[model samples]
Target chain A: DAGITQSPRYKITETGRQVTLMCHQTWSHSYMFWYRQDLGHGLRLIYYSAAADITDKGEVPDGYVVSRSKTENFPLTLESATRSQTSVYFCASSPGTGAGPQHFGDGTRLSIL
Target chain B: QQQVKQSPQSLIVQKGGISIINCAYENTAFDYFPWYQQFPGKGPALLIAIRPDVSEKKEGRFTISFNKSAKQFSLHIMDSQPGDSATYFCAARTNDMRFGAGTRLTVKP
Candidate 1:
């Protein structure tokens, strides 16, 4: 497709297990971000990548790890998924890290049991 | 403190009526303001956006009114339709984007 896509639209994993959410964008945007959305909290950024190998922590980065080996893919990994980590995960990308509009993927609904 | 605050956690309006959602921010450095619309089980999509330089921007039936001095902005939908029913989020961005808690709007036909 021409836009961003997220894998495993729905996922259920046990606590303490590792889970990875994948995000791929066809636009080859330079900036990619991962956000977790929960009730009362609109969208909290977990991590963002400026370029292929440059990444930074966002508002809520604890327990989540992100890596961008290529411009088109930004994957978020939960080393030890906890029940508190159960939330809808969204992946977005923009042309650059500056003041630009972001295109969001459908999102991955992760449920930790 | 919430960087961006949105009012009216929920709203209901009849078809063809106007729907208004308000948002305010504390940061003056925010140069870009964008609104996002989200449906249940879906990611948010950019509805409209405006810069601090302009007081208002309109696209189709959606309009964004910005007040730089007051650090506030609002989204007004003219002749709102049932299809427009969704959760709307107001966001401000300088280098990083921060979104409001969100407002759920339901338009009944």
Candidate 2:
């Protein structure tokens, strides 16, 4: 497809297990972002990458790791999943940092048991 | 402090009625404001957007009204319909973009 896509649409993992959510975009955008959505919290940014090998922390980056080895891929990994981390994770991409509308992936629903 | 604040956690309106959602921001540096609509099990899609330079922008049935001095903006849906039911998020961007808590709107028959 021509748009962004996320893998493992639905996942269930143990609390201490490691889990990674993959996000890929065909647009070759310069910016990619990872956000977690929970009830009452809307969407909180976890991490974002400005370009290849350039990433920065967002509002809630703890326990989450993101890497952008390629401009088309930015993957988020949880070193040790926790019950609190059970939420719908979304991946988005933008052409650049300023005044651009972000294109979002369908989202990954992760449940930590 | 919460940079962006949205009101009316939830809203319900009958078909043909108007639906309004409001948001306020504390950051004066925010120059761009956008609203996104999300259906169940789907990611949010940009609905309409506006800049502080203009007081109002309308596209189809959606309109964004901005008040720079007040640090507030609102979304007004003209002639709401059942198909319009969804969660709407108001967001602001300057150097960074931040989304509000979101408002769930349900349009009934």
**Predicted complexes: DockQ each:** 0.68, 0.67
**What is the C-alpha lDDT profile of model 2 across B1-109, one tens digit per residue?**
4688998899999999999999999888888999999999898898999999999999999999999989999999999999999999999987667889999999999
Error of 2 at B73 (Å): 0.4
lDDT by residue (A1-113, candidate 1, tens digit) is 59998999999999999999999999988999999998777888899998999999988899999899899999999999999999999999988766544799999999999
Report the Cα lDDT for residue A5, model 1: 89
Q: What is the lDDT of candidate 2?
A: 0.92
Q: Single out the weakest 10-residue window by summed lDDT for candidate 2 chain A.
A: A93-102
Model 1 chain B worst lDDT window (10 residues)? B90-99
Give the per-residue lDDT of model 1 (tens digit) for B50-100.
Answer: 999999999999999999888899999999999999999998887678889
lDDT of 2 at A109: 100
